[model samples]
Target: MPDQVLELAGVAVLVCDPAGPPVTTTQDALDLIGAAFLGAEVVAVPASRLNEDFFSLGTGFAGEVMQKFVNYRLRLAVLGDISRHLAASSALRALVHESNRAGHVWFLPDLDALEARLTTPT
Candidate 1:
């Protein structure tokens, strides 16, 4: 399936296809960000679509990718459970906590959570 843009909770969201290519590099992330420019205020990517290095903060891939979205003024919602990654790294856990709190980059459990976040008053 191809990626699609949908309106959710009054926000235009570009929901990426899980079957599509994995986001492994900053260039790949930039591609997605560019795609989201089609009237999308947010980009929702499945956790499965992310490269393994994305969860390993030591590689700095996660920070780079996320910074791109922020720099472009686009919100990113990483959709799916990341318990194993969070459990392994204290720094990652802290990052998730802070990111979610900041409302720019969110590591959410699923689409429902993302919708809830969009609908909820901040």
Candidate 2:
């Protein structure tokens, strides 16, 4: 599926397709600046499209990517069901919880949840 930009409420969001190449590195995160600059305040990337290391809390892959997004002042939502990975690691669950609370990095269950976040009055 081709990637596209969407408007959730008044928020401009860019939803990346899971079918494309995985964004696994810090450089990949920086590469997304093009979309952000184009008025994408939020980016929704599927969990399946992320590198496995992102789920391995010890690897710090998620943190690196999140940092890049945060530096750009753009929000990131990791969408789709990641139950298996979460079931395997309590640390990941805790990390996700903390990240969600931060409001910049989110691990959402689906696109609808991402839409909610974008639409919810903040």
Candidate 3:
């Protein structure tokens, strides 16, 4: 796995590629967030590289990650289209819809959209 800080749309983002199972353990998620928060205003995680499940982090692991997001008051941007996931799970599609409605996280199509969303005034 490779983890590093990257600048996106004038924001420093900590990017990580676990290159294994799609699921990220809560502990690992926390560690990544902690590291990312230091140098970046936002964190972008690639769903494909981390896990193989329908949802990038898997449903169980995603809940834990969401808790961390609340605890840290951090905004998360998940990169890539989730067409594969949408095809696999109706529940996941609903979850993604709810997440977007809440505005704490975003499942964006590409870096440009991600960057624009991050930089645009809320």
Candidate 4:
């Protein structure tokens, strides 16, 4: 499937599919950011599209990728339920919570939630 780009309350969002290459590294994140540069302020990547290392806090993959996104000033919303991953790692759960609270990154359960969050006045 292809990536869908949409405008939610003037915020450009790139809704990516899980069928493509997994985004697990800083370079992968940079590539995704490049795609979003077409006019996207955010990239909504499904949880399934990420590598296993991304969920393992010790791997540092998530941190590296997210840092790249932050450096580029682009927001990221990891779409879908990652309950298993969260349950398995306390660090990751805290990471998700902190990221969501920070407003730059979020691990949401679905696209509807994503749209609602992005559309709401911040």
* TM-scores of the models, in the order given: 0.97, 0.92, 0.77, 0.93
lDDT of 3 by residue, 10-89 (tens): 77877666463344467766776777767676667776744553264454667777778777877777788678878888
Cα lDDT tens digits for candidate 4, 1-122: 69878887678899897797888677888889999999999999999989999999888888888888888999999999899999998999899888887788989998888888877755
What's each prediction's clash count? 0, 0, 5, 0
Against the unseen true structure, what C-alpha lDDT does each candidate score? Answer: 0.94, 0.84, 0.70, 0.88
Ranking by TM-score: 1, 4, 2, 3
Runs in model 4 lying further than 4 Å from the true structure: none
* Best candidate (score: TM-score): 1
Candidate 3 wrongly placed segments (more than 4 Å): 18-23, 53-59
Sum up the clashes in candidate 3.
5
Tell me the lDDT of model 1 at 60: 97
The true-versus-predicted C-alpha distance at residue 53 of model 2, in Å, is 0.3
Evaluate model 4: give its lDDT.
Answer: 0.88
Candidate with the larger lDDT of 2 and 3: 2
